[model samples]
Target: MTGGSGGIGGAVARRLAADGTAVVIHYSGGAARAEAVVESVTAAGGTAVALPGDIAEPTEMSELFDAAERRFGGIDVVVNTAGIMRLAPLAEMELDAFDRMHRVNVRGTFVVSQLAARRLPPGGALINFSTSVTRLQQPGYGGYAATKGAVEAMTLILARELRGRDVTVNTVAPGPTATPLFVEGKSEEQIAGIAAAAPLERLGTPEDIAEAVAFLAGPGGRWINGQVLFSNGGIA
Candidate 1:
């Protein structure tokens, strides 16, 4: 289940469905947009259902997962791309923003991952989203980086927790993706500058990140457990 139905989450859901996995595409708002994604999947001869929920709320998340069970019968992969990013310096960050960030990015991930790890049929994989800012230490991204850092810290430990079950928990950190989420308040020039920072001399794409996710969700990445795969086009 991913958040913000418009960008990376949409791409991930589509790519996974294309790989022949029955995808349960989760969203909070943007019902129309979510349905559009499902339509595309079905049109392409894949199975998918749009399940909506607030990742920050346990009851909502429960309903979302329940829908997955009702439709697919057995859970194989859980990709968590649901997240929010509100920028502010440490002093300017609001309590609400901090609370919201942790609630969704940290607590929400725990709720989703815990359930998946415990209930996944063998060969299941859990994929969580992180950010390269955790490594770049970009200014004004203090709180955002903290949430991703927490995700990274939990990814490996969860693998150990589920070792006996053969379930794998890992994290993906992308750098400078051209998702609508990143262009919210930036100027075109500012966006270009950030793109230039990557070694590939271009911004990342949702498909690029989704391709990595499909790998983990598929058989080839079965042996890759507890890893933080960075799909950032060589961006530091």
Candidate 2:
């Protein structure tokens, strides 16, 4: 899992571990946070390891995947939740911010997905992360949404490309969630308003998103290929 140190990513790492699947928690800069997630998983009798690498770099990511395969003997499911979000209207957004977001969110996902497409064997899966903002069409998210839109676009094509490989390529798009990623810059009022926008009347939890991912990666979702699953609690 890439971005395994972030709020939603960490939750996904633990959730997958709980299912008795050995997890390789991948992080970009949050070493301590990633280690904590691994520790938690091991404490619960699950196997997990924290690996650090730049997701946008293929060589580094290839090494990371190699290390993971060496440790676990093989990889069955690859979930990439690594992304960075910077909110600004397209008119006011700095070019640097836009470039950085795309570097991590778009290029990074592409790099990892390419690797998964080439390496994963039969019964393997490639799960990528997207955001519901693409459907919400909210302001200040044009660039960020564009990155995820690219992810969604690549998902279906990649699934088709892997036709006879028995591999599934899918994307999970989450709505407003209570993670640090969503709550960092927003005021309580803004958070509450967005949360209330969903009929569920609350922000989604990371675990809620994880459940959707777990399903897709597990046997239950074998037939669910070439699709984008929105785990957004009816917000969009």
Q: State candidate 2's TM-score.
A: 0.99
Model 1 lDDT per residue over 1-236, tens place: 66637689889988988888888888877899889989988899988888888787778887778778988787889999988887899999998998899988999888888778777888889999999898899888999899999999998899988867878788999999998778888899999999998878999999999999999988999999998998888877
The candidate that wins on TM-score is 2
Q: What lDDT would each prediction earn against the true structure?
A: 0.86, 0.94
Best lDDT among the predictions, by candidate number: 2
TM-score of each: 0.96, 0.99
Off by over 4 Å in 1: none
lDDT per residue as tens, model 2, 1-236: 99999899989999999999999999988999999999999999999999999999999999999999999999999999999988889999999999999999889989999999999999999999999999999988999999999999988899999989999999999998888777887898998898899999999999999999999999999999999999998999
Candidate 2 has an lDDT of 0.94
**Number of colliding residue pairs in each model:** 1, 0
